[model samples]
Target: MAATDRAEYCGIGIRGVAIGIDSFVWFALLFVAITVTGVVTGQVETGAQGVHTSLSGTPGSIALGLWVVLTLGYHALCEWRFGKTIGKALVNIRVASTDGSAPSLGAALIRNVARLVDWLPSLYLVGIAGMVLSDRRQRLGDRLAGTTVVSD
Candidate 1:
């Protein structure tokens, strides 16, 4: 294979850093969204009932739903449109198909969806193990989606 055709996978340390950056970004977004929502709705009740009301089904469910959308949308759109999230860009990495091209929306969606599996038992232990074990340094999501994260 030509040097150009030989894929160079990104290492775990850098990938971890990229993920850290994305996590920080996600946290900021969630904080802002929740704050704005609370201010606009004035949903906070007073006294002991306040906590209960805030944690009750509707508001809590709405928050959860919004979080899921924001998180998944962020990953899916970024991967599809740019092959990289802001964090991935900052880290000089990108996601691409096995043949080394921009991934399709289906591939992006599959990877992001499979992220749930990679996240099993918390802190992405399964993903970490997969990346460590895989020849292309793929996490479970990447493997399932037939994609890999590589240095750009």
Candidate 2:
């Protein structure tokens, strides 16, 4: 809402669409990786309920660890390097510092890490609350990183 700014802050609705796209991609990637690892490591099971994996032992731990790394790294690296992930790019939005510069690597990392906290209590309620309360429509991650998703 600055006089000189052409880029407007995005709200939760469009942001939600971008996240849906990103989450679908993330889910697909995780499904493949976990399924392959589980089968290869003999950690998968076919039950009356459904086909699933026991992510409970060392193999499970490693798979979970990989998920953590991939999820965080994917968002942070993309935001740092290009200001947008594929979903955000498709939505024509980008993350930028409050001062209108590209976000730094540290900022991007903090933003993605804060996503864990924002995801708490299910369905990104915390993030939505933060965005609603913020004057610039920032989620917790954006506020923490001094970044905002903006129209491109």
lDDT computed for candidate 1: 0.82
Tell me the TM-score of model 1. Answer: 0.83
Q: Model 1, 1-152: lDDT tens per residue? A: 52215867986898889989999878976765565555556765567544322444665666666776788788988999999999999999999898888989999999998887888989988899999999889999899888999888
The lDDT of model 2 is 0.88
- For model 1, the stretches where C-alpha displacement exceeds 4 angstroms are 1-5, 32-56
How close to the true structure is residue 29 of candidate 1, measured as C-alpha lDDT? 69
Which lDDT tens digits does candidate 2 get at residues 1-152?
A: 64216678999998899988899778866876688779889989898999988666788777777777788888999999999998899999899999889999999999999999998899999999999998888999999999999998
Candidate RMSDs in Å, in order, are 4.1, 3.8
Clashing pairs in 1: none
